[model samples]
Target: MVTIEPIMIKGHFFTAVTVCLPKTTLLTISNNTGYIMCGALDVGLLNSRLVDRKIIAGRAVGVKTIDELLMAPLESVTYEAEQHGIFSGMTGVEALLQMVG
Candidate 1:
């Protein structure tokens, strides 16, 4: 399980990980004002250490940086290809906003 410590990146905000899902799938919310990852790491508990996390499911690989996790050419995975399951058809800036929540 990849447990991300509760950190206030850049000191501007904190992530309230309400649900730790096994898969980062998607479902829309607030009429598209915001979106949520269906299954992800649980990080939204109070007074909790990040070490207390479990792994439900994931690929054999992981990367912490966008650059390190270079994907295939943009042409390979169409914008639509990545939208349905994991991101609800969103990526780039849109996807970043979801994570920043």
Candidate 2:
């Protein structure tokens, strides 16, 4: 697993990570607004992380290769995420909103 410190992107602060397995790779990104998971990572895995956090979390799809994960379009999102106007098919970078919380 490779992790990055929270960095500013599209006006939001996000911590990006990539996990490599024997046959697949997964990406996880999170910010004050929400979390986004790509590849085979399960959204349920984030429940514990969300218990004390007010941010939303969702899954991103449309990725045919690991390299495309960051730019891939969203496939499913949580209600809180939708409130930010992040919808299915929106790119990860485009879905992010400035942190206000």
Q: lDDT: which candidate is best?
A: 2
Q: Listing every candidate in turn, what is its Cα RMSD in Å to the true structure after a full C-alpha superposition?
A: 13.3, 4.0
lDDT of 1 by residue, 1-101 (tens): 33332323334232322223465422211112222222222223211443233211111113233322222111112122233322333332333343334
lDDT score at residue 10, model 1, on the 0-100 scale = 36
TM-score of each: 0.19, 0.66
The CA-based lDDT of model 2 is what? 0.62
Off by over 4 Å in 1: 1-6, 18-36, 39-101
Model 2: lDDT of residue 76: 71
The true-versus-predicted C-alpha distance at residue 42 of model 1, in Å, is 18
lDDT of each: 0.27, 0.62
lDDT of 2 by residue, 21-98 (tens): 676667777765567778464545443455344447567764544346567887776655666676767776666552
Residue runs of model 2 more than 4 Å from their true location after superposition: 41-55, 62-67, 98-101
Give the Cα-based TM-score of candidate 2 against the true structure: 0.66
Q: Which candidate tops TM-score?
A: 2
